[model samples]
Target chain A: MNLIFWSSESDDDRRDTQVGSWLGELDPGRDDATYWMRFHRDVVDGSRFELARRRQAAELTVVGVVSSWSRTLVPVALAAAAAAGIMLAQPRLDQVEPPILVEDVLTMGLGDPMPALFVDDEEGGLLLASEIY
Target chain B: MTSHQKIEDPRFGDGELVRRAREGEEEAYALLVGRYMRPAYLVALSVTRRHEDAEDAAQEAFLVALQRLEECRDPERFGGWLMTIVRNRSRNLLRRESLRETSVLPETAKSGEPLPDRVTERSELDETLQAALAELTPVQREVVLLHDLEGWKHREIAERLDLPSGTVRSHLHFARKALRGKLEGVLTDHVKG
Candidate 1:
């Protein structure tokens, strides 16, 4: 007989059934509406939830602003770094002599028949590749 | 399930409610809490066993859920996400209860004095119900409560609990059978038409 009507006889399915109203009464919603109602209020209106919400909102605001700033500042900072990189990539001015010296060019360009560089050697004299050989 | 068991607000779905709550709408939050309150309580009850602990766990879970609402990722599945929090909080409470068991005796621990509202005749039945529930596995208790108490379909229980439909039915069958066995005399006496 139960095989045909298990669904209907199932204890306190709570659909117009007195089979297990006691179990249904155990439900907090039914048993203690006052307490659960207070619980709902506490969750929505209690200072604890409000404080937590405000705290989260503040933290999110701070994070949101910082992230927005990063979105803008990050590329600009990167480009500035890139510009510095280009300048650094170039040879240092302090390590190298000038491309041309008026004195060396004047005297050596006149004296040197062999087409050569008129760069002054470490001794402050014009040096030629042919002379070194 | 009763009409009150599900979403109290038919106008707004869980997603819209979550979005509104995230935008700091207290009404939306109240709706959300009202919607999930029973389910959350039942889930916590499935784990914590004690009603007061279950209530505490459920309330704490709601607060934690609100605090971490943004991390929910899928607003549409707010119920599932809240259930997860409820489960975790229940487990945490159980662990705390286990730890506290050694050091402190609970005031409500069935003293000679009758518990409030617990008329002697009814309290014995309540104790029998609790004892029967204790005999069930957590999953069994959950399945039975969700199915019989909430009037959920087996398939709904399966999807919500991630169990096969057959398994849900099996659990429901066994859980009810066990409760019937445990409360045979009391159930016969209390059965009204």
Candidate 2:
């Protein structure tokens, strides 16, 4: 006879209970409990970290990679910052600009609209954009 | 019905932990997660019926629970509340995933290939157990896993699940019976080995 509310007596039934217990393994092991602890610590401390960087750098300087999804998720703040930097470095989309010729493309990064001296084939030597006809 | 507070000497009660967590104490929140992770996962498995989806749903639910800590009106019953989040997350995952894929037995297991080591045996056994668990009703699965696996009392399961204690017992009795029937060979071999 089976007793639900009492200690199970039958060993076969006991073993069955263990089989049910084994399903707990489907949860990530206790290591995840620790990993998430550390991850939350980093989040609380305002220390930004990357899973890929932790792997490449040979040291978990900030947060450790906790799971498989670590490889896929870039730190959103880092991605946003990188994107913003690239956008700022590029010319404003709203501004009208000349199409990039070879020399103009080469000179595009010199500075913020600085008067760059490029070799002028028409005038034969280094001349500022203002000096060019 | 007893809370895990009575099962083990956790340093703080769920109400206290929830309060501390809401106050930005990561340690308290981590403790809560550690304490309830398995129960949360089991609850998720009840709804998802797939280990992978259950794991995702459990983790997502924990995150969501943490985010909405303020909304947990009854922090003392945090386990019950978290289980609700887990169930909702699992159902939402099902709705979103639309039954992605069933657990297929590993190729080696299906081919009758020799399991070279203990690792393979455990892996195969785990999948088999999952498949067997799929046969039980959702409530039965939840009751059995919580009562048998997590070692919760029948009354605790009843309170958490909002079922009568007697009903919880009946579910457990029948769930174990069903599992015994389906897992007879596997369980016998496991018992012997």
Candidate 3:
């Protein structure tokens, strides 16, 4: 449940950090370079197996894991923290001001003659901007 | 007949490839990957801005696309569909790793094999271009790279990025102006040195 986030400069740094942590949990006297290598390999293999197991348990194909991994490398807790940060940092779409329309700018230039201006719509139909408003 | 036998007919279009892939033909799927991998990587790189991350995202997108191959309404437009997947995956990666620090200029690998002087000069230019590209916003960078670097038309770029054609044109214009300014500065600095 304790997911250590890898923020190291390189993959080697991540591997070393992970290996060092794993070695600390084991018998130091018995952990040789070969043992460490095997342990590292097993950890990586185990991660893959865990991913496959979870995918199958959820009744999803291996391909479904692609989307899940693409969405987040963090666990639920860390992802929640990220979501909270994002909510606090970014303004909601409704809260943000709408883009200034070309018609609005043109009307502004014309000394507020009217709030309407002819513009081409998405379907190539000419309509008054104020009509839509 | 086997997929290999089908492929040997010399008339295997993208639509045919999709059909074969949907039939669980691994060779057909591999062919599709070979066809789109470079453009997919380029599209992803434009968004991710990191070679390794772009590569990973592109590879993931391929898997996702393969899974959803049946959902493609028009198999002839598979390249565009695959590109959309790549762009989405790249954007997802960007959002997930938003907090990660990124270098302004990505490191370029020197070729181990000997290259002609012209090739080396072009490579340096490409490096400068990439550095300038790093300055643009992600959307601007994507449009510019797709239109200019990948030689995609504005309409094609718009479809791939799910933007209006006019919007694509606007982004391309601004990106080109910015890139020209940056490249000029680099050239001036080179001349001074």
Candidate 4:
């Protein structure tokens, strides 16, 4: 997995804040919590250095883990989700919305909310949107 | 071979380096990377107009160049070939990430003021040049930077940019004119100071 970090002014911090908040929702007791903490620390340290060098006012940084998704896993994930949905009255599978077309996603306005259907743990690690369906 | 040996050989030119690199010589490839990294970064920066993006694009271009080293017909012009890859990669990145969000002008331009008199003449000139370069269209900047800064001929720039030689000449002419117009005041001020 590759770790990506982005830093910007606080006024332009919307994207980082949103991604940070989403990551915060994950259970801290999970096995991957350590990885997230390390990623966060790296981001904070990197942002501090960058901000100090640039002398920018009110810097913010966001970090995320990105892993490649295998093509074969798509069908497997779909089958598992469908099976789990049929077994449970409240279908978590329904939460896995159809993958948005790349063109449609590209056309979306900057302010539009991105669909967050796929979870990162196919190989038990974070998968980027580009990596996932 | 040791780094000392690589540096010592007068006959070991770019073609020799390319041949060695093709034969799995890591030292030869490193030498090539060292030689071209700056120019490659400049080419990418001309397109992307951002330092970080330019660095990333240049690094990726080197890797791609290494992988496709066999495809190079003339090792003598490896710099131009690698630059072509860098240009394409930078343009592809610009397309993928909408340029509207990423194409920011330099900080000097955003600050919107000439530097104080205490600033060195060279520093002022650099800042003015940066700002003027930022003002140019991407294609114009690319042509001007390659031709003027890199000392590439119009034919070389045209081949890499995939434009006609006449168009490259035209772009270079207009870009220089625009730069001169933008910098005239700064130059005059510097001289008077």
Clashing pairs in 1: none
Off by over 4 Å in 3: A1-133, B1-12, B98-131, B185-193
TM-score, structure 1 vs. true: 0.64
Local accuracy of candidate 1 as per-residue lDDT tens digits, A8-100? 325333322432454665675665447666777767665355645654675667779899899999999999999999999999879976687
Prediction 1 global C-alpha lDDT = 0.73
Interface RMSD for candidate number 1? 5.6
Score candidate 3 by TM-score against the native.
0.45
Off by over 4 Å in 1: A1-20, A29-33, A47-133, B1-7, B103-122, B191-193
Off by over 4 Å in 4: A1-133, B1-13, B99-131, B154-165, B187-193
Let me know the DockQ for model 1: 0.11
Mind giving the per-residue lDDT tens digits that candidate 3 earns over A1-133?
Answer: 1222333323221112221221122121132434323322333333343334433545544667776786675577688899899998887768888899998887675654654478888999989878888
Better of 2 and 4 by TM-score: 2
lDDT of 2 by residue, B1-193 (tens): 1212222337789999888677556567667776777788789888887656887788777777877777899998899889989999999998876533235455675687753432443466667777788888898989888877777877678778878777777778888878777777875665445
Backbone clashes in candidate 4 total 0
In candidate 2, how many Å is residue B164 off? 1.5
* DockQ for each numbered candidate: 0.11, 0.06, 0.01, 0.01
Top-DockQ structure, candidate number: 1
| lDDT of candidate 4 over B42-112, digit per residue (tens) | 67887887655776787778777776777989997787788889988998887876654347544654586
Of models 3 and 4, which has the larger lDDT?
3
Q: What is candidate 2's lDDT per residue for A1-133, written digit by digit as tens?
A: 3445543333132324455545544544432545434433433333112222322443333454443246555576579889999989998877987677999888877877754466566657667666666
Computed on alpha carbons, the lDDT of every model, listed in order, comes to: 0.73, 0.68, 0.61, 0.60
TM-score of chain A of each: 0.30, 0.18, 0.20, 0.18
- The order of the candidates by TM-score, greatest first, is 1, 2, 3, 4
